[model samples]
Target: MPPTPPEPAAVLARPHTAELTGWGRTAPTASDVRRPTSATELQRALPNGSPRGLLARGLGRGYGDCAQNSGGTVVETTDVDAFTIHDADPASDTVLVTAEAGASIDRLLHALVPQGLFVPVTPGTRYVTVGGAIAADIHGKNHHRKGSWCQHVTSLHLQLADGEVVEIGPDRDPELFWATAGGMGLTGVVLDATFACPRIGSSRLLVDTDRAADLDEVLELMASGDHAYDYSVAWIDLMAGGRATGRSVLTRGRFATAEEAAPAAGPDPYAYSAGVLASAPPFVPDGLLNKLTVRAFNELWFRKAPVRRRDELQTIPTFFHPLDMVGGWNRIYGPQGFLQWQFVIPFGAEATLRRIIEELSASGCTSFLAVLKAFGEADPAPLSFPAPGWTLALDIPAGVRGLGPLLDRLDELVVAEGGRVYLAKDSRVRPELVPQMYPRLDEWRAVRNRVDPQRRIRSDLSRRLGL
Candidate 1:
């Protein structure tokens, strides 16, 4: 008799077939999307030894192919969300929260804030899932002080390829744990995680904003004063040239006290609400965000900001993720989509940063939504992106001509300066340079190979980068 197919209960956990893409909407590919509702279901979902393999996917927030596997299985973890919050841990001083991999940071905030707690780290957007956050080891504006997401993660429950579940953390299987932190899901599927959740007084941020004349002024201000603030970020005018090149608006802040938020926010100091005002139209014409329009917008944005402002009250959404206010914003990039290139260079490499900035400005590249932040330290994860340096993130419409060559030259410069592109946000990095950029790639591969020697766990990104 022929081999039996996977049982209905094993294979049909909300099974479907579709074409999927990351948040950037680039590199779309077909996959079998399986949404397993529980750990037990997920354990039985994968076939014994499928060639295409399986990769876990969360909210699809990554701007690259890390979460996508062409002609393979994409286990959508959204249905596995379950969480519990503990007021205090007897063994430690911090509160404890065990959230399933699928739990989104936005939902966690809704549940935790009422009880006076907040996540230790959050990226530019709260839409990210707990699993995605761990896989990427995301850092936020406050990374200088608190560190990456995995720093706060106490433990993880991972399901291996051979149909076994294992618990790993800093104390037990430290190598595997650290590798999994930013291993891009090559190690195993992260089922759930236990992390420290810090208590907070209010949800508002008391912000101070300063408009710098150029890149030098902005970097100097951040390097000098960033230590005092819990969070800091700068929006650079990439189109500006000459004396005004790299002009930016720097904003820094800390969570507000209940009293500080009362005058304008009224009662319920911990109130949190994020709503989308509008969605970008489904079909934006190609070339709509061309150099002329973007440059004009950049100038207006830079000119309108206050030269300096203090004690400005802002909502969590406004301070961390203004882009969330507009749903389907990616659609604004047109059908061809857009790609986000985020890279970090060590502190002393400011000259290289300046050269890149000059190149972008002179090339007439229109990236109005560019951001610059100062990263304070490197974490233990080998594949983790941040370091003690300056990091810049900007979006480029994929339709732009000659873009590939421009980025290739930029990559060479970045690699020369000991900088690495963020895999979480990358879609076009050269495979040959990955190892050079991440010196510890072999170390991470060793751990991954031990757990998944057959390479049953793979993705488009893993293949592209030869991971």
Candidate 2:
């Protein structure tokens, strides 16, 4: 049985704690945080009245302010962790799994993969929570072949802003269902969800790697080869110039069958570390990752990953999330941290991409990690960010002068080319441009207002963008 809810007054006056965005590191602020271990406690902590204000926070993996609230209450959902394998249909080759929103995808996969099952979708990092993944409608390398995470979700147990706990799915409250998928927690707090899991043969990924001479070559490879693999992604050397400008290394992979699988030799599957469990030191020297250092790193990475080859016996973590193994890795960007800029431009806007890449090169703002991927069909969610196009993601340190203005210019270019930024990783998109990027903004707002008439659902991002 779950524990009883805590009294609302008991949580008042409690110290506010900020998240790991590192934004608060240089200038710290606080919020009244509630870490409820059960749904009863969750209900008790919600604000009272017609529109109860609250925000949900997972692992704090969101790059910007999406998971944060300034003065309002924040419900830390990490305590609601639980996972149950409902059924495994051997004949149908599908697995039905139910997990509390707080369960981390990495932890869940460690357990599922050994049993020959895998989540249908996963972001670049497995550290994200199931609830966070759904709220953001995250897309993986396989997005070209599969849709966003919402496409696999069978049902969601949500706690509405008004304190009503409801079960919503395709068959029930379909509008609320789609809205909550990419809703960014504006609709309600996700309690738990059930989704379909794909069957896997082994823990290894059969990978095919190749190098592209430029952005155009990268796109051509993806367009021609994406269907042959379950997962595909390209790492761009943003600093490369002239004929080698936008040079990239593309990797495509699929689950290895028993006949192709190698022997496992590592820590027991269930005992793997939770990942980067510690934060970076309070202060880091500035200019630690400036142009010179970044350019050198880019050269090494591109040269190391040869032109074309096949690599066998690849571990799951090395293939899907190489960054997770390094603890306190964000510190590499120094104390100011970094901003991940990810935007997608439609297929016909090749010229727009060329212009954006040219600007980055001219400015010498070489992103250490620049990834390019192709997006397939668009999701139905009003706020979903993916579509049939090419998406580029770059991690830029925040301390650079004129960085904000450059981003604003890029935003203009994106808007002009019919592109949109990912809200989960954004902190600076203009409010007016948001409606333009998301045509269904008003529709989502209507659904949100209907559920929380007083506009209780709020967050730093929501308040900043007027969502």
Candidate 3:
């Protein structure tokens, strides 16, 4: 007798075959991909799920495997994208925007910025969907003023593994709400989210640029002065050594008032352009980003900035997301891909932070992208990445010598200092260290297991970390 095939409902869920990778271009996984238009449609496929389980993918902006479910069902929410903005109350400095699971920040910003509104918190790239932001609980350059993405979220609709739909928020089903905030989309699939967006007078920012001589000076400058700005980030030249080690270009700013804006904003002050100036070549040879090239690039980048430029008007894209200006920028690293390490150590563990930076510099690994930021108060989500600390994020090509063992050693150092790497950006952390890094893992999983008793929702990251 021939075995029975899945019904149309199940077949619809597993629409097609595809190989998916994260933004890092690392670790490709095969899956049965589906783009369900609505939650009801998505729920119909829940019963016939495979033992390998299922996972929901947003815009695929995550740098690692958190969004990947190998040999399983991967539901895409791009078609489900839709959003509605309620009336704004500038008096209260609040605007409520509700977006579907797939509505991207870029599209939302295009609509909202014209209305003098801006997301309270946005990751480096705006192409990420609202659901992705909620899942990752992303933070922006303005952590000192704002916080993680979930902090501004008032409420959300989540569909559990058993096909049950529930609305969760800070005050409603608070446990599940916080769990899903930074649970890496493991708790459930986010259907919709209503979060607070602040009123911005213009799309331009009043930026202040300062060049820090070295690691200590930059740390001191950010520790003492970050509070004065709504947005702050320091770009470190990782290739520099000795007195120049950790030399940085610190840029800080707040939204420009209508009067402070310049002509660059065009006739309309709130106008925004999400344009890509160039695209990386399809085939870049490996080792193109070696030490000698990176060193030269870093030198040019550092020299381009003014010593102490204050109140220089710049557009949102230039200030917040310079990498977004180039499409497929990850391909520049070539086939093996790259690793982005983002870890936050408590303020008291500055010594560990310095030691880690020094090790990376001395390791002969070539890297141009390194940034440091100061975190504010912690998010309510137990799985949330940020806390009161100093976070450093850097990119290194995978082909570099001693990369794996080096990161592994660095992980031990970070864990010893009571710090943890961002799971959203992680692809290679050891399973045993996960619990040690996130003490509330069991608490988060308890809530997750209740919703997904069989653990039907799983991703490569969940499996890797034994979540």
- What's the ranking of the predictions by TM-score, best on top? 3, 1, 2
The RMSD (Cα, Å) of candidate 3 is 4.5
> What is the Cα-based lDDT of residue 119 in candidate 1?
90
**Candidate 3 lDDT, 284-355, residue by residue in tens:** 999898888999999998989889999999998888888889999999999999878899989999899888
> Which stretches of candidate 3 lie above 4 Å from their native place?
1-14, 38-40
User: How well is each residue in 289-310 modelled by candidate 2, as lDDT tens digits?
Assistant: 8889899988888889868988
Q: lDDT of each structure?
A: 0.89, 0.81, 0.89
Estimate, for each residue in 414-435, the C-alpha lDDT of model 1 and write its tens digit: 9999999999998999999999
Q: Which 10 residues in a row give candidate 2 its minimum summed lDDT?
A: 20-29
Model 2 CA deviation exceeding 4 Å by range = 1-29, 48-52, 263-282
RMSD of 2: 4.8
| lDDT score for candidate 3 against the true structure | 0.89
Task: Provide the TM-score for each candidate, comma-separated.
Answer: 0.95, 0.92, 0.95
